[model samples]
Each structure stands twice: as C-alpha cells, then as structure tokens.
Target chain A: MSFSHVAIIGLGLLGGSIGLAVRAELPGTKTTGYDADPDVRARARERGLADTVLDDPAEAVRGADLVILCVPVGAMGEAARAIEPGLSADTVISDVGSSKRSITDALVAALPNHQIIPAHPVAGTENSGPDAGFATLFHQRWCIVTPPAGADAEKVASLVDFWESLGALVETMDAEHHDLVLAVTSHIPHLIAYTIVGTASDLEDVTRSEVIKYSAGGFRDFTRIAASDPTMWRDVFLNNKDAVLEMLDRFLTDLALMREAIRAGDGEMMHDTFSRTRAIRRSIVALGQDDPRPDFGRADHE
Target chain B: MSFSHVAIIGLGLLGGSIGLAVRAELPGTKTTGYDADPDVRARARERGLADTVLDDPAEAVRGADLVILCVPVGAMGEAARAIEPGLSADTVISDVGSSKRSITDALVAALPNHQIIPAHPVAGTENSGPDAGFATLFHQRWCIVTPPAGADAEKVASLVDFWESLGALVETMDAEHHDLVLAVTSHIPHLIAYTIVGTASDLEDVTRSEVIKYSAGGFRDFTRIAASDPTMWRDVFLNNKDAVLEMLDRFLTDLALMREAIRAGDGEMMHDTFSRTRAIRRSIVALGQDDPRPDFGRADHE
Candidate 1:
C-alpha cells in the first residue's frame, strides 16, 4: 500500500528534500516534519517543506504510517526515541543516514515494535538546512535500501515504490555491505575533501586568497563537498568509524606508495595508476552517475 | 606591436586550445603548430587546430613572432631545443607548463638569445589531446605569466594582451612563487584524488561495481581529476617535486589531525574546519571561477 501519511524527523537537507519531493511527486501523501531547532522549524514552515511543520518529533509522527528519521547518523537513535510516544505500532520506520549498519542497529534497538528498514538516499549537494531542500535533489540518484533480515516483503516493496516516485533508483543490500560501499564512495571522499581544504588553508607559505583564486585548477571540487553540513559529516565519520578508518588506511597506504614513486621518479608507475583511474571515470559516466560534460558543464569555464 | 603569427609546439589539449582560441578570438593572427607524435599532428591538421600543422617544430616556429611550447613539463627543454634552428632571435619564447621554474630555466638555457617567459593558463579539463581541446577552454580562466627577472616589459605586456584577447585574466608572478601556489591549488589536489581513487579500487570488501554505481556520493568528483592526462601529471610531479612534496607533507599533517579528531570523536574540530572551508567556496563562486549551480550544473544531477 502507498503511504498516505509520512513523518520526517530532523528537517535538514535530506529531511526537507524528502518533504518537498513528496509534495511534488506524490501529492496524495501528506508530509509532517520536525526539526529540533526552532529556527529550522519556522523556515520549513515558510518554505512549505512539509504540509505541517511541527515543533516536536512526537507530534510530527502522530497518525503517520511511515516515519523517516533524517538526522545526523549519531542522532538517529534519539530521533527515533523522540517519535516513539506518538508513533503508531505498525509504522514502518526508515532513515536517510549515510552509513547504514549502526543506524539500523540503533533504530531497531530504539523502536523494537516497528518495522525498521534503514535506507540511504545516495544524493545531496554541499548545502544544508531548510533552504537547501529541492524537489529534484534525488533525481537520477541511487537510494540503497538496507532492510533488516526479517523485513516484510510488502513493506519493502512499498518503500521502494515511495523512493521510485521521488525519481531515485532503488537498490537493496545488506546494511554491513552498505556501510562498506558508502565508506569508499561517500564517507572517505568527504574526509579527504575536508582534509585537503584544511590543508590548503593551513599552509603558511601559500596565502588563503591564492588558494581560493586558483581553486578552478582542481581544488574547488573538493571545497564543494568539504563545505557540506559539518555536523552530518562528523556524525558519518564517527558512526561509520570502522569502515571509514579502514578505507582511510588503505588510501594512506596507496598514497605513500605514490609518494615513493614520485620521489624515485617512477613515471611509469604514476602513469599506470593514473591511467587505470580514468577508466573508472568513464564507467561512472557510462552508468549515468555523472555529467559527461567537461568540468561538469560549468558556464564560465566553457 | 601585437603578434601577427603565433606558433604552438605539442598539439595536445593546451596547445591545440591556444591555436583554436587565437583563431576564434584573434582571427587576423596566423597560427602554426607541431606535435612530436605524428598521429597527433595528423589529427590536429584534420581538426584545423592551427592555420598550419607542420611536421617539425622548427618549421612551425619559422617566422612566428611568438612560440609557445605546450609540451609536458618534463619535455620543456627538449621542445625548446627542437625549435632553436628556426626560432627568430626576436621571437618571444614562452610555455604552458604547470611547473614554471624548471621550464623557465630550461627554455632560457636552450635559447639564450631569445626572450623566454613561462606561462601557465590555470585552466583545463581532465581530457587531453587535440580532440579534447576547444576554443573556449581558457575563457574566464587565469593565465599566470611567470616571467623571469629583468624580462622585457613590452614583451610581457604584449603576451598579457594576447591572453586577454582570448578571454583569460592575466597575473604576473615570479616562476618560483607560481610553482608554490600551484602546488597548493592544483598539484596536491590531483595527487590526493589519484591516491583516493586508487585506494577505492583496491578495497577488499567493497566491489568496484558498487563504488562506480554510488560515485555520485562524492568520489565521482575525484575520478574526473584523477582521470587527467597521466603523462602530463607525471611530468608535473617530477618537475615540481619540491613544492608538490612540501604541499603533500602539509596535507598529510592536516589529514593526520583530522583522522585523530575522528578517532577521538572531536565533532567540534571537524565542524569548525569544514565550516571555515565553506568561505573559500563562496569566494570562488563570487569570483566566477566556477558555475555556482548545484552539482557543478550537471544535467543528470539536475
């Protein structure tokens, strides 16, 4: 059955985007959302991010058939708990956390009576808050549904249909595997971007203004992501600690080998590694995951 | 006096772009080009990358008032030497190498009687070769001119005007300072991207297909840059070893601090660092170096 009433906890980018997308794509479904911060709640009301922007999570989830907690990964459990009082016993609970395993466990533990099928919509921009929500944020994006082992087939199908209506392609994977995949694809990339931007700013010899001016050379792409919602990313790195750390370790090892190759003037090795990575980009473009236009079709650059 | 004839050595992305840009923006200017690779020369000829695509660098430079060497950074000396036979003593010699210090030194040593001014058009796509070039590549990009001390003012001003005509903002700096600034902006960003892409592909737990499918998460941005011309990037690292290494060292140190913060659950540290970098992005967008559209204005993402 299609969801008639959907509740969203934590009305930030993902939460608010879901509300807006549902309003645009599934007009029959009513969206109720709550943010812990009053400023965000008022802004969400002004933007009509949801049909109803409630001040409390409990009030937001009342009478809802589906409740999606869209808070930072670390706060998933608390958000779920906050909605527990008003949530119906049969409500299917889900989330849009970057890392799935911990969130799934935390959610399942907090809402033992409800259907907790954690999902991560692998879509976003660097911007956040009520203003960042848009109807097309999930268009052509992937949303991985990491349903727990005993999830009901009908509920899973219904959730899939919900995301499909919002223009996201749906994939199913085990939560553990989801964490591992996203660790490489999302978490580590955010970390590296954050690290490099910090690195550029911290350099004493290179003026910060120079880094900003020449960022079009390559650094700007990283800054777009490094500027992402800090709290959300911080929670991602912390909650997905093992997977993110493991990926970071592998990245550091590979980087050290590259450093040695450069130091030894091993042009062939650097060239081979760089060449192999190019194919991955071609594959990403082929899969329609990225814009094939040069420099992502930036106007001035063209 | 304005240059009526311009010669380009190495008909790759940068060289062919200069030829095409001059043809489009300065229609009266005559362009001659050569590539050491006969296949690239033939392709350039087919594309009409220049008014004439000559077989030899010497022939290409004959009667040219300005000759710009656009070979790999490591090949700057050899490219300059090859054109020595036909290069006029009055012709201004310059190059489009990412690393300017070694290139300037090499060009000066190879053509002691000619004016050698090194330049780097801080613009490019990841793509390479004649097929990868277009006339508009340098529009609104920075073309840093790194002329050595005691360089002729008239020659530098003429070169600046030439670039300005083709739609690039020009800035003059010492070659050494240019190398250091680029080390922070471009070189280090590229090395980190290459390393992370390699690391992601090498993961034992995450499948490559999964990584490719979910690259929209942020890894896709790195792949675009990691997919850059390996030979050119290899040359850049080798030629600008000191500055690149210094920047790399600084990046690693900052990254180490970030890793520690993550490990210690220092959310405030990550939050502040990530927040500070947002200003840099704002400044870049304000300066019009990048398209301010979400997701770099990608069609699929839009």
Candidate 2:
C-alpha cells in the first residue's frame, strides 16, 4: 500500500492476475504494464489490468519502485533488458517463471543495478493471455522467492509482503533447490502429461474420438495439463533440462519396475504402489491445494 | 415408478450412489440392498441407501423385479450364483462392474435362468464404501450396457430407461466392443496413472515428499487416478488383459518416440506433440468432459 507505483511486464495471465491481486489487496499502487503484443496491452487497458499501458518496457517501469516480469523463461532476458533503463536503483525486480535458476541468472545478467529478487508463484491455470487473469488466482498458493545472496533484505521482505497481501505463503530458497524441487513437483509431471496426451492424440481416428468421449476416467486430467501454454512449457523443459532429465530418469526407472510387475502379474506390487500414492492424494487434499469437493465445471458438466 | 421393487447387491460407492440416485429420480420404486460386509450393509440401511437392507443377497433379490449387482468383477459370478435361486424368473439382472465381458460371461454361466443385461455405469471415485455414495454421482454420466446377442429387446429398452431416469446416457454396445472401447478409454489410462504415481512414490524420501508437497502443477491429477479402488482396478487390468495390453503397447510406443525426441533435444517435436494434444483437450472440453476455461480449478473472474 505504501508503494506509489509498480510495473508488470508481459501482461499475460500471471502479470494481469498479479495486477488484479495488487489492485484488490495492495490498494492505490498505480500499476503499469508492458507486453510486446499490442493486443494484450489494449485488452489490459479495456479491462483496467493496469493504470498505465505503454509500448516501451522502459516507459512502463520508469517511475515504479517494484517491477515484476511475468513472461516465458525464454523471454525473461529480453524483457529484463528492455525495462532496465527505466527501473530505479531501489526497485526490487522479480519474475514468475517456472524454472528459478535460469530466470534468476538471466535477470542478474540483464539488470545489474536493480535488486533482483526472483519469485515463482506456484499457482496458475492452463490458460494464458491477459484475459485469463483473476483476483483469487494467488489465494492460498505458494510463492517461492530466490533472492540473490546477501541482497537487500528489506526489499525482499517488501516483495514478500506484497505477495502475502495477495494471500500467498512466501518461501525463500536458493535457485538450484527451487529448480530441483520443481523438477519433481512440476516439470517432470508436466512432461509426462504432455507425452501421455500426445500419445492419445496420435491414436487412430475412431479410437481418438472414443478417447475424447470417455476421457473422464483419467486421461482427461492429462489433457488439461498438456493444454497449458505451449511456449512457456517448451521453454521450461529445455531450460531446466538437467533437473528435468534427472527426474525423468528416476520416473522411467520406476515405470520400468511397474511394467515388470504388471508383466509378472504381481498384484501385490501394483496394490502397494497404488496405496502409497493414495497417501499423497490425501496429503494434498489435507493441505487444501485441491478441493475435496467435486466440481464438474458447468461448461463441462452440462 | 411402475416397477414394484428393485434390488442392489454390494452397497459400496456404486450401489449406494445408485440407490440414492434411484430414490431421488425414480419415485415410489421400492429398493433393497445387500452387502457382504455387514458394516456397509448397516451403513447403507442407516443412510437409507435402499428401502430394505438384507444380509443375504438371495433375500434381497427375492421379490425384486430388477436385481443390479454393483460388486467387483472377480466376485460377480459368485454373487450372481448366490442370489440366482431366489431371483424371480422374469427379473432383469445387471451389474455395475468395470469389465463387462468377463462379468457378463460369468453371470450367464452362473444364473442361466435370469435375463442378465450386463451393464457398467462408467462413473467412479477413489473412495469406496457406502459413506462415499451420494445422489448425484451418476448424474449426466455414461452407463454402458453390454447386452447379449439375442436378449429381450423390451427388457433392454426398460433397463436403458432405468439408467436414463438416473441421469445417465446409456450406450448399448456388444460385450467385446465395450471391452475394447473401455480398454482405451479407461483401463489403459488407469494403468499409466498407477505406473507413473507408483514411480514417483519410489523416489528418494526428499524428492518423494517434495512431489506430494507441490503436486498442483500436474502430478496431483495422476494421484487421484492412481488412488482409485485398487482391487477393482486390479481386477480390470487382469480380466481385460489382452485389450489393456494392446492399448498399453501403443501407449509405450508413443512414449518411446517422445523419449527419443526429448533425448535428442528436439524442441520442434516436443512442441508439435504438445500442440496436437491441446486440440484433444479442446475436444474434451467441448464434449463436456472437463473445464476448458483456465484449468487447475480456477473459477471465472466474473
């Protein structure tokens, strides 16, 4: 609430949603937005995604003390440099990228003068673009901040406070740890989803339609995950290849073991594996990350 | 409403939910239920899952015009045999088992006198037992009826009417076609989910905990599928082995191709695969299988 201005780069789901949350919860902090897509900027203006929409990133960040980049990992460096000239020396710059280390590295390289406090709000939808934002997107979600070592503690604290006001639980971890953790939690899982859905998409015409028709069983879940923004996910897998590959290796090895068990008709092994994963579902439900209540979205339910 | 009495055996989620749905939609049709587990039978009675609760399956089916067995596939034959002696000669019997061919064949062998219309209401949850049942579980879901080649057309039509009244779209396919269709739509997908989640569960403790902690990205979706009723799913894979194996073979072939692409760092291939699958998600969303608008359960901005 104390900050007079904030700059949001990219103006997509993350940026626009942050603008909405900041407006709803941060109060009177004039938000500015920048995106290469002129249509997104126009939509932002119509929807009041930000108080000011500008063509140049520098102009958007010119007077703001806080600048947030909410673009794909592949675009972070360019966005960072474009806004660097307008960012104040006291500005705390952050990003909502899936891979922490790559974006943090890029930010450090692109804007040396600004306080680069990398953040990843571990909450989002498969949808993208400015129109895909909402105020409650960050509520009860995890926000991981990987601050540059021994950097401005107060600036980092302020940014964390801002996220908290948006109802996110702030966590601070090193960039490598963040990437490794997300590899298991998000990256590898996303890759598998993309692959599985990809597998189904290649099915014969008749089978493919049947797959879509009766997908409610389980494949529907993978389809939702695979439908995420293609460019963002493509960059995530490429940028975090090592961590992704490591996690993928472990996953493949485990899958091989499962395949063997199934081949051998080892019901005990299958049952045990299923039972163990059920505990994970219980934990997630307990943590309230997933709604225990059933939701057949009216669009889908109808 | 015209049917004097209906009976459901095995009052788990399927039977109990069926009973509740019938009670809500089919006025004045007396229903009775039987469960092998007395505790479940008592819960079904207390919760008014049926108009009557009987310990003996035969006693429950004695006077009912319709006897629906909502039991595991492995037990369907035995259950059919147990209640056959008391079932009315004109009574139409059905079962809500996942695999139709195996159960239907068994029912024919066990209860030669009864007009068995093997049916499977293709809706479910990870939770089992009577307490997990609710009135709306089958609302707007599919119920596949694998009627025998020369079965009574009127009986089939009435059975279809019964499910339609309970808010299901009834699709009557032959047993073999139903098995093949379900192998692609349900069984193979479940196997992959179980395999992937099983793999994650076998990871090192640190990564394992991290997987559970941050499952919102994608893995949590698989967790729900993997957490399904293990015994029922196990029986499904076992009974529908040939069909499941064929689908699994195709899935593995596709997955291997993806693995090669990832290994070669072919961004174009990965992107192509992902982009194609997004269309399937769109179809599923369009077909009312899942929420297409900003997945991961984010409500509309409004």
Top-DockQ candidate index = 1
- By summed lDDT, which 10 consecutive residues of candidate 1 chain A come out lowest? A293-302
Which run of 10 residues does model 2 chain B get worst, by summed lDDT?
A: B293-302
Query: What TM-score do all the candidates reach, one by one?
Result: 0.97, 0.94
- List, residue by residue over A246-267, the lDDT tens digit for candidate 2: 7777777777776677677777
Poorest 10 consecutive residues by lDDT, candidate 2 chain A: A293-302
lDDT of 2 by residue, B215-265 (tens): 676677777777778888777876777777777777777767766776777
DockQ each candidate and list the results.
0.80, 0.53
Error of 2 at A60 (Å): 0.8
lDDT of each: 0.90, 0.81
Which runs of model 1 end up more than 4 angstroms from their true locations?
A: none
lDDT of 2 at B5: 84
Docking class of predicted structure 2: medium
